[model samples]
Target chain A: MSASPHAAGSTETRQVYLFATCVIDLFAPQAGVDVVEVLERLGVTVHFPAAQTCCGQPAYTTGFPEEARKVAAAQLDLFPEPWPVIVPSGSCGGMLKQHWPRLFADDPARRVQAESIAARTVEFTDYLVNTLGFRLDAPAASGAPLRVALHTSCSARREMGTLGCGRALLERLPGVERVEHGHEAECCGFGGTFSVKHPEISAAMAADKLDALTASGCESFVSADCGCLLNLNLSLEKRGAALRGQHIASLVRARMDGAAS
Target chain B: MSAASLPQADARVSPEDFKQRSHESLHDAHLRQSFRGAMDFLVERRALQFPDLQAFNTLRKLGENVRQHALAQLPDLLERLEARLTELGVAVHWAETPADANRIFLDIARRHAATLMVKGKSMVSEEIGLNHEMAAHGVECIETDMGEYILQLDGDRPSHIIMPAIHKTKEDVAAIFHEHIDGAPLSDDVNELIAIGRRALREKFASAKIGVSGVNFMVAETGTLALVENEGNGRLCTSVPDVHVAITGLEKVVDRLEHVLPLYALLPKSATGQAVTTYLNLITGPRRAGEKDGPREMHLILLDNGRTQAYREARFRATLQCIRCGACMNHCPVYTRVGGLSYGTTYPGPIGAIISPHLMGLQSTRDLPTASSLCGACGDVCPVGIPIPDMLMKLREAGRHSVAESITPPAQALVGQGSVRRAGEVLAWRAWRVLYSHAALYRLFAWLAPRLRWLTPAWQGGWTASRAALKPAPRSLREQLARRRAGRTVPGR
Candidate 1:
């Protein structure tokens, strides 16, 4: 999954497929829009394949492999071009990059296709910091500094190993203070179906994560994965807490705009 | 003492009530705080031990490779171990079930006419209900390990594997000792409590006819049963008694003595964050001709129970590589918050979740697999790289699909396969697959979801309990992207 950033940027036709994950599709479309705007600004042609739907992570992680395979099979041929497939959510990106090969291992025809596509799959923040080398020229504001807490999803941290990529992106901003919170590496407990399956346990985890982020005295938070954003932000809203999480795509896009202005 | 006269546990906890148990455990602030602190301490100690990430990864890989190599030749190694032990005058018994192992123990006790048995901390003993079995047969089995001894006195089951009484504070332990032991003082002092347990267990160790223990590594080449512990109770259990019996899972055997070194190197560090345990007793056999301080008779029971079931599956074979290090639980987010007691199984935490379904079957342990969030913390810290999350996912699949629907053959299917397969859940997933697989259907639904966001339910079972209700955006990403392609300004922008 690691291609040289210079090689990525120097490509004559630097076009990529945007796998705007299902969560970002229905709930956080602004994140998808922000990602598109940022990539266009970086001179990368972002193609949103209409055929792409779900990544089948929900079914796969929920133990319905057969169902997951069917759903994953749909998107196999959507990225026919030999271009990088950039996913906004690490969870969905991981399902494509890591699990897709295994999901189609039994089928010889799909196995080759899965592996080929998997090599091109990259998380959004990873593509930004590594491939594009896009960083903020200055802080988001010359006024009061933006105190932000970055929440890295477990999938992003362990599976994708893109926590550093997101952290680097945010830390580069002169005015964006990336505050460290308690159990920074721990999960936010928004494990797709896990949130609904064991609600109490999931709620407890979200509460702790929210409290830690709030306790860090950050004005807002950012996460690479929208699932964690939805889980943490909604939980904070439910608690009537002022702290909330934004997708890294939206946060980075705003920072880039601020620098440009 | 008749078999009927033995006291039973006050409450026989079952994994069937995992949801309820976890709910209650989550609500207990004291229990939550206790486990959080304990786990944090253990996690920190482990981090300190493995200061160099590169070295830790290399050693962890070596440990995993050794176990994997052992597992590949498990049958041959086990046979060799049995032969070696037999030659060394150590009675080696193969048990296919928990009952078979307990029965063999009973037969040995009956042969010796034993009324008392002293035991070191043995998870296999717990797995087989060894103490209750011995007590039922008029043989009193005393737990010599301070933590287990405290739990035994309180009539409580072990929550954590290594730290059995970790759920209890020093004060709770002191109270239990004061109430159970005759003329014992109620003191929360750690040394005093340990002394009280030792003073009580010393008499039992001296008088007991049989000693019971769990082997850490059964070295096939050397015919040695390597037992690791901190308090020296394992050495005392095997040496002080006339007859010593050590039981372990069939998967514990390694091909050589050298193989145990790497595993042993990783075991204590991964388990209790110690460089090495206090005692590493390598029992070759019974007392030699000149030896005066060893058991006269030695027995080793290799219990299969449900391990063979797990070993049959290639993916699940990794589950057997576990050294019972308990590192997975210490770093697990779910285990740290909920505590081990919530599992309601003999072995709790990440290891328990993956292995319990095999032992107890998917029907009873269906909830255990799903309890975790598939967080990779357990897998990251597993001493042998068991890939616990993958194993849990496998179990979840095994438990959810019917025999015919499952890829696994009927004969090779997990016990109680499809036990937790609810018609509603299956239907829901099927519908999800249908909708998501079709591009037009998915887009339509995606568009409709946000457009009708107001119609979204206020209540969504457990999802809305601690979080606001999930509402879709005003427009779908696909719709917005389509508009952008058509050179139109997006409404939100």
Candidate 2:
């Protein structure tokens, strides 16, 4: 609709079908809103199809495959192919793109459709850097650079293999400084039903994640998965720790708004 | 020593014990720190072994192929192995269960009137509760491996398969030795501790009536047993005594000698990151008629235990491909934090999580499958390319009858297989399926959940315990989308 700021911005029409994950849809609506706004500000049309509900990760990871198939099959017709289906969370994005075909492996015809959807689905930050090619070269800032750490969820790190894309996003934010924690490869322990089944071990792992992030000397945190956000943010509150984790979409949108001025 | 006189474990593993152990382990600051340091060292050592990911994956493919092919022809290879070993003057015994294996060992020791028995690092022996059984029969058994010896002195089970005493620090080992050793003082210096261990075991090796060790790989084509070790004590346990008994599960056999080379390269590099361990002893047979050293008689015990059960099923057959490297546990976040004893199983961590279910049945090991975070770190690091996370999911499914029946149906109901079932938990999952299946119900629940956010339950297990209240937003995203499309000025906007 509008010309993008990129020097080599393509003249072809672009659109992003938003798959606002279940965790963000119910728990943190602001993440979904921020994701849509950041994409809109980049001169791309963002569509939030009302028929979409969830990507069915909660039951799938918790050893309920039949239930997962029922829920994941509902998403096949919600968005047509050719347009990239951008997802806010890497965990959900991986479920749609990487694991959907696994759920439909028993059937050949549905598996083809699942693979087609998987090829077009992209996580928000990955689409931001790799597809859109949006770059920030010392963009305008509203205040001093905010020191923050990034907590990459295990699903995002190992399953989706998108940590490099997450890093590229952090590097593009001119006013946002990224700090690396020691145990970056470890899980935050909010493993779907695992957090509910084994509480003590989950709390211990969350405490370790917080300690590593706190020790890295960051004011706050940003993560790609809302499951980690809900767990870590709550754990931080329980301990009365000043640290809080925001969705990466919120961080990127806020920095983009300041750059627009 | 008859089968009627066989003794079971004094304190059998129970599912309730695991819950208690995990609670205690999570609270123990000392145990947590020790496991953290030890696991970090192990993981770092293993990472240095595979700087090239492609090369590592290629080697894993070869290892997996060898194991799958070996298991495909297990019965034929085993028969070949017995004939070859018999020709080499080695006694080959077949055991169908832990009780049978123990009885065979005790009968052999009694025939020799063995008083003192020396042992190397053998997880199979621990799996069958052999040390305690031998001690009950009035045979003095001493653990010869340093880690096993320390655990024996401390009256503890081996926490890790490869590094049994890894949970103990230098100071902890020193204190354990100072309490148990009947000798001069040894400081915290590791070399001094090794010397003390070496000196204490040497006399036992010289005077022991029999020695026992674990086999890493038993070549079926030539009937040679390959023992991989870094301590050099395995060589002593197999060669120093008048009689040597090398015990291992039937899954340890490979088709040919060359099939063992890929696994040998994988085990040490995965266990302790050595290009080749200090000792790679291949025992083909007993000492010849005029040999100056080595055992006078050698016995190889092929214990089935529960491997035959696993080998019969295609779903769990991949579990038999393990090489006892312990890399899976080293990379597991849960095992490292909770330590090994919390599992209350002979083998702990990822491999234990998958294998113990088949060996001991699902009733006792129900908690092991749920212990992981499903991080896939262990699966990624497995040298033989065992899909550990996928296997963990299978165990979780088999642990519950309601879920397993729903997936596989009642016509093909799993028989003789043990599973742990909870009625209330089944009702919960049933409710979950009902809620997620229908979009209208999901939307209605989403609409009400946020408005009733204050009524969020505080008793959501670990969720609300250490985190803030999980209150949903006042409005759903679909609600916002509808208002925006209708040309309404959203309050936030």
Candidate 3:
């Protein structure tokens, strides 16, 4: 697996900024911890900038550009070391890489700073598969067989173009089988404020997604974004169903630990 | 045809009722299934046609460029189109508003004393409330397209742009036909239902004094109106009557006949997954001297209806590039679940969300832009490469802010600017900006939230409605990181 095309030869010890997205920071801190564990085990030093608050996706996507710009500007100085900024969630990483430059389009100084930061920003799964060559096979892959559906967030699919990174990482795990679900490319209806603004429609979409994943007969699911995991896990919990989703970071970390044990 | 057959009162489907309508639609299992099935089918068919991703992207780029070029020289091209059409003996009318469009239709109907006017499927006509206006003035406008004819008979608005009656199952259509049309029997067979509709529309076409249709593209160089349809009704409506009135949004004009080919190629494939539609009527003039069959007189109505307002800003000008393929809706997860009628507008789904704000004003369509999950499906599948999600975000900003507050104010404010901007929501965002932009404040808040997790509320506004309440984790990631960096193992891990 380490010799695969997705594997990187540059796994020499390197320091990188860890941007535990606000969603994972507050509600799913274990996922954040797992992200750190996964990175560190792969011969990388994870630096968590305490001042990092958010990637400003909620404000930006909710149509508050001024607020979003100000919030995004706050984090521009955090990753000044020229090291790669690893964001576990593709949604937040996309905000940094794709939208931050647009948000600061009129301000040349901030735009340059934003572009520099964006150039170094990479989603956790992409960094693992593409940069770190962290594929699991043989000894690492020997574990209790787990079946899971992979839900790629819209940002991962469309913005950052890391749609295949999660699947690639999982596919290399010999004991794991990725179950395909209906409308696999569709959204999970956790579009930040969109869920609250249009609850009925959002819930309806979430319900359909849940049905599709359940029908796939996967024991659980994994996604690279916390927003989607929160939406799906909570909905599953509400329905008193055992089918739930975990962040890809947490899933990978657990799989590694299980193999070691 | 009886005037009573037309829908009464032109109350533009108000987005104010969007929440309620969507609630009803979400609860309607049949409607949900119908939309899901139909959208899935359309999406699969379109995917089958575009096997090579690179080829599809290249064609999409070309389609986008053609539309953008046409719009860049829109004023010049429109004038040239009018000049060429006038030389061909086709009357050209420019309408800046829906009222202006209706007035032109009424005047033309009166000139021809057109009591019976047969229409091809025209979303523009729906936008201008043409059917109601014509009926009010004692003119019967019969929808000749099968899907539209079904909707018209049920006094129901179109739910989908390409497939108007998509929300209705075959049984529903059978019931509609059985009750509405005299001597019509109930039948769920697709061919039988289409035959029944064609039979009814044929008689209407024969007696109609005027024919009305929508243009897919208008070529300025050759003075041609391009119409694409699966049904032959668009051709019939343009040629069978003594007079033809073709209406289209002003944005449809292209510089030449060649420019129309790329857009034409993408339209039907993106629309119904067809390599080519059954009828492609290119009307250069009313009729030539030796023409066997065509309308004697032709009138082309160029409708603005808020399109000029959209064109004023480069950010939203992409809205005009839409070829009305309805591919956006077909690929949208939100549209698939909620169905089109939930939008409460002439157009529905992703395209409708962006364009309705311009067409009907932000006040009436403020909620429309927020209807999507920003899934990016619409933008991906768009034949002409309309950046629909970005346009929606722009519309959202326009709806929530005043002209002075806009990051880059347009030359003129959009219609109903700041219509949805409430003081409470404004204050909430302001507070959010405060908490997020200040690292110290955000850090303090993040620390306190998990510590005070016990005090979290059980019922979050809409969050707890269908999902379990989201509670703060025992410790935030920052706290864990701090402890780890301090050379102390985190308590939990």
Candidate 4:
């Protein structure tokens, strides 16, 4: 946990900034805590700038880019440069790495700053596998592995390419097993505001996702995006379904603590 | 193919109103299953076609270049096409509106004293309501494509462009044929049904004085019109009858014959995943005096319903590049789930979502733009490289500002638009925009959400409609982190 894994300077001690997006800040704080624990255990010093807020995805995806730009433009200043910004949620990582640079396209000065931020940002799972080179050490399954379903968020697949990293992280755990399901590539229909805007279709799609997850015979689920986790967990709880979903960080941390749920 | 549940089977077939159609389609188990199977097959087939990534990209780039070049010189190409067509003795007509186009067709039919007209599956015809217009003039417009023929007999509009009868199962088609066609034996075998339809349609093709078809590509270099199909109906519509009348949107024009190749190559493949359709007919002119078997007279009717509206905006012209391949819908999660009937437009799926608003205007189609999950699958599969998700978002912004027409009584806004404005939503987002832009207020709002979680569902639109409850967590990460930082005296993480 002592040797610095990455940085341009290779100073032997590397520090990283955590952009715990608004969703993690509000709806699922435990996921943020688990992210910190995981990174600290890997010997990376994690710093959270209290001034940091959201990645402005709600407004950006909702057809209000102008309103989104106001928040997105301001976020570029929260973290100073060259820390390799790590995000727990791929949706927010997409907003930072993929969406923010586009927001400042018309302005040269801000666009440079935005691109710099985007270049250094990485989703936690992707960083864990690619940069840190930390392999999972499985002790033993003790006869039965804990079956957990994994939901790959849409942005995570498209922007971050973190599905591999998430799977690789899960593969390292002693008793944790990643379960496969039909229609895994299809969206879970929790498209932020789209769920509320078209609730009938949203609920129908969520029910279908649940059908696939439960059919896989997994007792619980974990996803990189809290947006999907929130929507899926709410539906599961509402239906009084036996299956539950947590953010991948919490699931991994919980597995490290000897339980899946 | 599965049969729909008996009670609500026939309840919501029309798309005159999108919301009602979407509501009923989501509840229609039969329709859902039918679309699911058809789309899955189409998506898998399309993926298999371009297994070589480098070749696929090459083909896509070529298609995009051809489309962009043609669109850049559309007016000049159309004039050149008209001149070449005049020299070739193929009558070319310009129709400004749907009424004009239909009138031209009826006049052509009357000139030949045509009573029966066999047609290829033409979506443009559906858009202009040409069959209904022809029927009013005592002309029997018989659809030759098996899918179109089934829907024609059922008096239902096309649900999808390439596969018009996809919403109907073999059993549904069997029931329709048995009910509508006299002495028809009930059969669920697709080949048997196709044979029956071919037998019935073949009888009319010979006796009909005029044939109607839609043009896939209008080649300006040689004034040639290309028709692509699987059932061989398009060839019959253009060649079997003495007088051939072809209809298309103005945007289908190509400057050179070679320019049409890349598009024609991708059209069928993107549609049904075939390397090539069974028929690819290119008609240059009418039958010469010594020619064996072709149309005696040929006419091209270019309809400009709302294409110009799209052309006026630089960004919107991307929609015109589409070849009507239906690949977008095949990969579209939303369209596959709800089916095309829910779109209630001539074009359905992602293309329809962007194009219908311009054709029908923002007044009636405000909800169409918001129907997608913005997963970008439609954009990914588009052959001509139309960024449909970008256009969808652009249209959504346009809808928010477009003047609201007085909605008729009893038809409230589906989500939020028209006469019924979502005042709370406007305030909620506006307040959010203000708060999130400032770090302090953003933290304050995030902290307040969990404590006042009960108030969310009320303002959350329809998110809680089916669920028992939807709530936020008890604490914010900032508070938790602050607590840890205070207690440990050393930022642990």
* Highest DockQ model number: 3
How is the predicted docking of candidate 2 categorized under the CAPRI scheme? medium
lDDT of each: 0.87, 0.82, 0.88, 0.81
Q: Write the per-residue lDDT of candidate 1 for residues A1-261, one digit (tens) a residue.
A: 011224333756479999998899888899999999877767678889998889999988888999999999999999899999999988888889899999998899999999998999999999888887765553334224688889998899888999899989887665788899999988889888889989999999988888888899988888888998999888988999877788887876676656321
Residues A12-90 of candidate 3: C-alpha lDDT, one tens digit per residue: 5588999888998999998899898877767678888889888888888887899899899999988889899999988
Q: Candidate 2 on A1-261: residue-level lDDT in tens?
A: 121333374775577799998888888888888887777767677778766777877767666667778888877877774789998888898888889998898878789888988998888888888888766554544335888898888878877778988889888777678899988889998888888888888888999999999999988889889999999998998899888999988888777666321
Q: Write the per-residue lDDT of candidate 2 for residues B385-464, one digit (tens) a residue.
A: 89998888777776675534655433333333425657776677668667766778888988888889888777665688
Instruction: List each candidate's DockQ score.
Output: 0.63, 0.59, 0.68, 0.54
Q: DockQ score of candidate 3? A: 0.68
Give lDDT tens digits, candidate 1, residues B309-374. Answer: 888888789999999989999998998888888888888888999999889899999888988888
**Each candidate: how many clashes?**
0, 2, 0, 0
Q: Which scores better on TM-score, 1 or 2?
A: 1
Per-residue lDDT for B256-345 in model 4, tens only? Answer: 999888998888889999999999999999999889999999999999887877776685789899899999998888888888988878
Clashing pairs in 4: none
For all predicted structures, in order, the TM-scores are 0.96, 0.94, 0.97, 0.92
Q: Which ten residues in a row have the lowest lDDT in candidate 3 chain A?
A: A1-10
In terms of lDDT, the best-performing candidate is: 3
Q: For candidate 2, give the DockQ.
A: 0.59
Higher-scoring candidate on TM-score, 2 or 3: 3
Error of model 4, residue B117, in angstroms:
1.4
Best by TM-score: 3
Report how far off residue A158 is in candidate 4 (Å). Answer: 1.9
Off by over 4 Å in 4: A1-11, A141-144, A257-261, B1-16, B402-424, B453-460, B489-493
Q: Give the Å error, residue B104, model 4.
A: 1.3
Pairs that collide, model 3: none
TM score of chain A per candidate: 0.93, 0.94, 0.94, 0.92
